[model samples]
Target: MDVSWVDGERRRVTRICDALRIRIEGVARAMTSDQSARTLSAESADVPDGAYSGDIEAVLITEEQIQQRIAELAESVAARYADAEDDLVLVGVLKGAIMFMTDFARALPIPSQMEFMAVSSYGSSTSTSGVVRILKDLDRDIAGRDVLIVEDIIDSGLTLSWLMKNLATRHPRSLQVCTLLRKPEAVRNIVEVADVGFDIPNDFVVGYGLDYAERYRDLPYIGRLRPAVYER
Candidate 1:
């Protein structure tokens, strides 16, 4: 055999080996990236359900999770309403928004006042009637005051739309909305929300002031209700 030919053949083999090594390293790196992404997705999906005496299917947002987000939202709110002349007024829709109103109000850095308005749309059904009536109105006049409508969730956006229009007639200096949860798919009206803690899936969720037949509101975390619990 020619010695020079043998040397050339060995050089070609070495080149092939190096190329394979580089290809294998690329594959490994890609697999690692994919695995890391999957891990993060799984961790985000697996929120821990707290020890609550309710038929919750899965915890959507834990108490700690909500509080953390609320802190961030408070910072945003304070910045937005910092230069207001009068103390900011937080108008909470009754029953459902009570929990969120209290927690978020305490989180705010600026001084604010709180009021409640009881409006009824859902009597005992999961769906809205699109007809909102004021069960209870605000005691203090909102005229010339910066009003923030705090709500637990914005499902169809109809009730909030109606509320905003109704309050607009009261002649508030400014009106804005801040909600803990919002359903993107369920929004029928173009209600501008100042801050939203979470844009959740359009599912029946109960907990943290949201309820089914006025139950599960005391649960420390927000959770998706089991089908059997609500369907029946």
Candidate 2:
């Protein structure tokens, strides 16, 4: 398990991080009067106020909220696993979840084990092709161990569903999922995600680890891809 394959993947991902489409304009500016997101109470249905491109049909979650939720999740995890040892294993879905794994590993409750796997139901295009494969396998030994699968986003749920079944054969003591984003609307695969950070609408999102044609991942914040550029 050289595991050096991750470095090249991250570099390739980094190069595609900056093409997010957020055009600054007078109308959109007027609507987004404030440059910063005003703190909203959890119960407040406060509308989003970031740079918008279209009907916002393309926008899903923002990086700010994701970080906030991640911290909260870490706190919750700390409280839950306080009495346990540092045997938590964090497995990240490749190509899309690499960025999330870095930030999430730092916020885990204890010193956890880390592993990466590349599985996808997506084609070269943005749409789901409904086929999943284990391109890369986990390097860590999960037999009789607690493993938490960290996913960037879960939609259609095909990949994770297949992964759950596949990993079950490994004899892990327990297996649970902690996804950064989950689109409940598109969930068809039969698997239970134990911990979820954010529940976003069913939209095609990019940035903060999501991509469109392999672009707009390092934008710091997630936003909808412009139809002209990605959705067509």
Candidate 3:
């Protein structure tokens, strides 16, 4: 029988696993006498409908885990900017990275200020067009200051690349990028990245500030969206 993991251990796992058409051969492995072992979910896995949908093949990173990484990133940033006579400007890409920005800035040992920007490439679909546009701009002057671009995801790096180029024209002392999730294949532009939290596959996730149709951002943990919900 095909076996799959349902994000639970005993009873709950059994419930979810039982609901699927596939038979259980093992835990998250062995597609049974049917198809090959599939991942937990899909790229546009994060969803906002039904009791249980958007359960894609996902590895959840907890708030505490994210906090730990932010701490490390803050330390690294603190050391680099320590020699500067001025305070650092943290520019967060809005919506997704806002929470991380707040926490990361709080973790910094140095004095700092924050600015917000909103840019999008996804339009109304699950995939990005690779062409990014600014929905909002920074309110503070970035000239001759140490700036850090905080982002939730670094996929199809076009947006970030454009951002770097645009920011450079203003002549910031230095512009560095810090992203929570970095996808190697999705980056289309070259930019100097400072610190990265996790390297993940190109899959959609909602929660911990990320969203699926602006839903699930309140979820404490990140998860792979279940496919059955979206495949329909």
Candidate 4:
């Protein structure tokens, strides 16, 4: 007998449910948007000058700056060897050049192969000893191949000069250099570099695969090591 009222009641309840569902959905969207904004802020936050346990005196180059330079270096190198017959061979100076080599390879527009050689002129010392030694040698012969020597940093140019002479014996079709960082001393020295990412000061820097006694290589950005850390 009251079926009409029941229908009205049902419609009212349905409307309430729809309204509640809409409100819930709106709250969820708002929460999601807020979370995304927070994530973006965290990612874009500026890295502090003394971010690395205060051991780094100052940041020489930020991570973003390093990456951008690397990309530009890669493009320049690729353009030079764009018409090469064989894939470019990247001869990375090991331990130090590992990071630059990998990143440069990935950024290169052309296909390339990798080889590493470990040469040392500075054995835990801040300055080069002026004597270069080969701690490791290339794994494969590079005869007749276009070779690019990837270096992390060149300070005095002793190690790079020695490496160039050594690699020259292999008779690569073409040999050139690409270094991520270089010092004023390196600039004065006569080693011809095909590409340089950044020409930094003569200060002792560690990070981005450059290190002082193997400590600061893991840092994302290049930084000057405090004199206290290595001077004593």
RMSD of each: 22.4, 15.5, 20.8, 26.3
What digit string (tens of lDDT, one per residue) describes model 2 on residues 1-232?
A: 4467888887556433311111112124323321222222234222255544342343345667778878777676556566665568888888788888888888876878789999878875767787887789998778767777888888877777678767766666556677777775434333456666666666567778777766767656656565667645
Clashing pairs in 4: none
Residues 1-232 of candidate 4: C-alpha lDDT, one tens digit per residue? 6999999998778656544543344334323421211001112223474447578777778888788888878877788799999999999998999888998999999999999888878755676787888888988988789888899988888888778766765667767778888777876666657677777777788888988887888888877788999878
All candidates' lDDT scores?
0.77, 0.65, 0.67, 0.76
What lDDT does model 2 reach? 0.65
Which scores greater on lDDT, model 2 or model 4? 4
Candidates sorted by lDDT, best first: 1, 4, 3, 2
Judged by lDDT, which candidate is best?
1
> For candidate 2, what is the total of clashing residue pairs?
2
Against the true structure, candidate 1 reaches a TM-score of 0.77
As for candidate 2, its clashing pairs are 17-218, 58-224
**Clashing residue pairs for model 1:** none
Better model by lDDT: candidate 2 vs candidate 3: 3
Candidate 1 lDDT over 81-194, as tens digits, reads 999999999999989999999999999999999999999877556888788899999999987798889999989877886787677666677777788888764343455566
Superposed on all Cα atoms, model 4 deviates from the true structure by an RMSD in Å of 26.3
lDDT of 4 at 100: 86
